[model samples]
Target: MEENIRRNKIVGSRRFSNYFWTIFLFIGGFSFLLAGLSTYLKINLLPFANPTQLAFIPQGLVMIFYGTLSLSFSIYILLTLFWDIGSGYNEYNKLENLVKIVRKGFPGKNREILLTYPLNSIKSIGIKISEGLNPKRIVYLCLKDERKIPLTPVQQPNSISILEEEASDLAKFLDLKLENL
Candidate 1:
C-alpha cells in the first residue's frame, strides 16, 4: 500500500511500481528516440540492415523530425515526474491549531509544496464508500471552502473494513464529525 494512516497523520507515498512504470516509460521513449536519432544521422544501428535498400537523405530528414518530437515529449514527462514524484503527508498539529499537507518531490532538494489551514476550518471527515464488484472507498476532509481533500489512502474492495476503521479513528481523534456518503 502506498498510503500510511497513523494516529497523528495520513500519508500517501508513491509506490515502487509507480517508479518502475515511470522508468519504463523513460526507457521506451529513449529507445524510440535513439532509433530515430541513428536513422537521422544516416547511421544504421539495426542488426538486420540491408544497405542497398537504405534511403538515406529523405528517410534521414523524416527520422530527425520524428526523433526530435519523441525526445522533446519524453524529456517533458521525465522532468515533470522527476520534479513532482515522491511522497506527500497530511498532519494535524493540535497545539498549533493547524492542519498541514506537504508534498515533496526529489529526495532532499527542498522542493516542497505546502498547504496549511486552521484546524477550525476542517468541517468534518467525509467517507465515500462504493461497494460491489469494483468497490472503492475514499476518505476526505470537508473544508469550509467546500473543497474536499483526500484524507486517507483510497481503499480496494477487500480493504473497506480497514479503511472505515481508520477513517473513523481519525474523526474520533480529531474530534470532528464523520459524514458517510
Candidate 2:
C-alpha cells in the first residue's frame, strides 16, 4: 500500500554506560581535586586520605592537572547526555515516496539535522561488522548517489545475527538489496 510507513527510533548518549562513565569521572575527579587541595593547604580535604603528607610541588600539582582533565571530560559527557545528542529517528514513507533521517546535534542553529531523499534512491541496506579491540556493528543505508548513511547508534556492539536481521528487515521494507560489508 502506498500509505504504509515505517519509523525506527535511535538511542543516543542517554544510555546506562554514559551515565556510569559520567558518575565515575565526577567522583574520581572530585576525589583527586580534594586530595591535591589538601596537600597544598596542609589539611585533610578528603575524608579517606591524608594528602597533607604529599609534596605540593609535583604530586599535588599533577593530581590537580589530572583532576581538571577528568572534570572537563565529565562535563562534556554530561552536556551531551542532557541534550540527548544523536537521538533521532529514521522514517520511510511510502505514501510520500520519500525517506527521512533525523538526528539531534549540539546546541546551535543546526542542532536538528534532517536529511530527506526519494525512497527509490536507496540502493541497499549495508551491515558492517568488526571484531577485536574496538568492536563495531553498524547498519548503513546505501544511497544511489554513493552516500552511506549510518543508521545504528555507536554504543555497545550488537550481535552478528541481530545486525543481520535488522539490516535484512530494513532492506525488505525498502525493497532494496542487503549487503554485508
Candidate 3:
C-alpha cells in the first residue's frame, strides 16, 4: 500500500492570470501616462476645478499626493502579477504525499473534515472537467489527509464513483467510521 503512485495530474488555467495582469498593466500604464500628459500640458485634471484656489496647500503638493497614491496601488498589483509569473504552474503528485478524502452530505449538511498541511506541503490539487469543452467540474483529489490510500485519477467521466472509492479506502486506512454523503 505504501508503494509510490503518482495520481492527480490536473493543471490550473494560466490564461485567467495572464488576462488579469494584462488589464492591470494597461490601467497602471495609462494612469502614469495621463499624469505625465497633465504635467506636460499644464492641465489640472483634479476632480475639483481650480484646486489651487480651493485648497490652502500648493497645487504641486496635491498632485504629488495623488500621483503617489495611484503609483503605490499600481506597484502592489504589479508585484503580485510578477510573483505569479515567477511561480509557474506545477503538476500534482499524489504518490509520495499522504492524501485525504472528504464526503459531505447533500448540500447544506454541516458535516465536514478539517485537515491542514504545511504551508507548501501539498504538491497540488486536481480539478477535473466533464468532457471536452464542457463546463461541468469537480475536485478530483485532495493531496493530503494522512488517512486514505490516494486513488489514481479516473480516466472515466464519473467523479462520484471515484470519490466513493477514495472515501471508503481512506476510512479503512484510518480505522474511522466515515459516513458517505
Candidate 4:
C-alpha cells in the first residue's frame, strides 16, 4: 500500500492483498466450521448420510473440534478487519504545536490510541534499512530524549530515495533535522 502525504499529515493504509487474505480466511474458516457443526448436530446435508452409520458419532466429535478451531480463527480475522488493524496515521498540528500518531486496534467504542509529542521534542527523522532475506525499511522520528518512534510501516524492498524523500519531507515540515541512514 502507498502512503498519502499532505501538508499536515501522513496516512498509511494496509495493502489490498492483506485484506484479501483476511477475507479469504474468514470465509474458508466459516465453511469448515459449518461442516463440523453439521456433523455434531447429526443433521447430514450430504446425500451419503445414513442414520445407521456407526462412525457418525466419532466423525461428529472430530468435526466439532476442527470446526471450533477454524471458526475461532475466522472470527478473530473478521474482528480485526472491522477494527481496521494495522492502519495508522501521523499528524502535525501547527496551531496546537503537537505531533500525533494514531494507531488503530481491535474493535471497541474507541479502538485508536493517540500518542502526542511536543513539536520541540522532535529532533530528526531518518530511514532505517535492514537488508537480508527478509528486508525491511522504516522511517523513524528521533526525539531529543533519544527515543526513536517509527513513522512508517515496515516496507518491503525499501528504496533509499523514497525513504529519504519521505523522511526529509517530514523533517522539513516539523522543522527538524534530516538524517539519511
Q: Please give the RMSD to the true structure for each candidate, in Å.
A: 5.8, 1.4, 12.8, 5.2
The candidate that wins on lDDT is: 2
Error of 1 at 22 (Å): 3.3
lDDT: the better of candidates 3 and 4: 4
| Candidate 4: segments with Cα more than 4 A from true spot | 1-15, 34-64, 86-88, 107-110, 154-158
- Sort every candidate by TM-score, greatest first: 2, 4, 1, 3
TM-scores for the candidates: 0.63, 0.96, 0.31, 0.69
Clashes of each: 0, 0, 1, 0
- Where is model 2 more than 4 Å wrong at Cα? 1-3
List the global CA lDDT of all models: 0.64, 0.90, 0.41, 0.67
TM-score of 4: 0.69
Model 2: per-residue lDDT, tens digit, 1-181? 6338988898988999899999999999988988888889999998777999999889999999889888988999999999999999999898898889899999999999999989888889988888999998999989889889899987888889988988898888888999877
Give residue 63's lDDT in candidate 2 (0 to 100): 91
lDDT of 1 at 108: 61
Q: Of the candidates shown, which would achieve the greatest TM-score relative to the real structure?
A: 2
Give candidate 2's error at residue 70 in angstroms.
Answer: 1.0
Compose the digit string of candidate 1's lDDT tens values, residues 1-181: 1133333433333445445555665565555455555655556555544332445466655655665665566565555555554346777777777778776655565778678888899999988887778777888888988899876553234376777887888888778998986
Ranking by lDDT: 2, 4, 1, 3
